[model samples]
Target chain A: AQSVTQLDSQVPVFEEAPVELRCNYSSSVSVYLFWYVQYPNQGLQLLLKYLSGSTLVKGINGFEAEFNKSQTSFHLRKPSVHISDTAEYFCAVSPRGSNYKLTFGKGTLLTVNP
Target chain B: NAGVTQTPKFRILKIGQSMTLQCAQDMNHNYMYWYRQDPGMGLKLIYYSVGAGITDKGEVPNGYNVSRSTTEDFPLRLELAAPSQTSVYFCASSYSLDPDREDTDTQYFGPGTRLTVL
Candidate 1:
């Protein structure tokens, strides 16, 4: 079985400040990592993904994540955040051999205040 | 392209009532999935279909049923509405078997349907 864990449930930060949302996963087999964002009253949208490449992965909206295999972690980072970035973020994992069945972690609410 | 669309964006049902949530995708995707989003908790897969005739259960399948009768449609049936089943539902589709984009199996999501059971 595969599972995802997001350490922080809520993160409050100021606009233009750096932020990091931590995520960890446990899987017996090789897996793919993904980050998704959900704004108020909207469905989730993919932020970034790590499918087997360079450890560092860049995503839209000036966000990035580093997939650390040894640490079993994929943490999403942003150099600076805006008020519009206030949303709930999620981390998910899918095993390589499966048909893209994703296991998602409890979301982290990122509140970027001005 | 209206990649994925769900009908009855909002609904309120009485306990023990039954209803079906309709989902359709215009991207010609081979794979489709249903999920429920609860507060604090992330989305949980309810069911998934690999093609028109194949469907499988996921993390949470109880109190729900799904059918895939065509390439463009997949509907989820709730036999008995319960408060526990009240949540935002999402439908997603992806071209999972496409070999060209093997590394990036991105799933496109529908706008979502909010169901309330009272």
Candidate 2:
């Protein structure tokens, strides 16, 4: 079984400021990682994923994440944020042997204020 | 392409009532999943189907049942609705189950259905 843990429950940042959402996972074998964003009253949308290759993965909306194998962390970062970027972000993981079925973190709320 | 569609955007059920959430996808994906999002919680997989006539339980499968009779449709049934079942339900589809598939880790989600049990 695989599990994800989002360290922060909420993060508030001023518009145009950088933000980072921390995520950690627990897995005994290889894993796939992903980040998803959800707007109010809407479904989730893929932000990015790290399967293999480059440790730095870029995503939509000027977001990016780095996969640190030693730490078992895949934290999402945005150089600059906008009001529209305020939403709930989720980190998920799936074990190598299992199907694409994912295990998601509790979620972090990013509130970008003007 | 109407990637994924879920019917009854909002629903309210009384205690002990039963209902089924309908889901359909047009992407011709072979893998379909049902997930629930609670307040302040990320989506939790309720059930998943690799293909027609095949289904498996997920992390939170209690009080819920699912059936995938065809590749295009997968429905989740909630029996004896309870307050714990109140949450936003989302349907997602992917092209394959193989972790390394070309479209792996890419899941298209539906608009979501808000269900409240009182």
Using TM-score as the measure, which candidate wins? 1
Residue pairs with backbone atoms closer than 3 Å in model 2 (clashes) = none
Candidate 2 residue-wise lDDT, B1-118, digit = tens: 8789999999999999999999999988888999999887778889999899999998899999999999999999999999999999999998754555666657789999999999
Give per-residue CA lDDT, model 1, range A9-107, as digits (tens). Answer: 999999999999999999999998899999999988989888776999999999999999999999999999999999999999988746457899999
lDDT of each: 0.92, 0.91
i-RMS of candidate 2: 2.0
- Candidate 1 C-alpha lDDT tens digits along B1-118: 8879999999999999999999999888888999999998899999999899999998899999999999999999999899999999999987765557743477778989999999
TM agreement with the true structure for every prediction: 0.96, 0.95
Task: Please list the residue runs of candidate 1 whose C-alpha ends up more than 4 Å from where it truly belongs after superposition.
Answer: B102-104
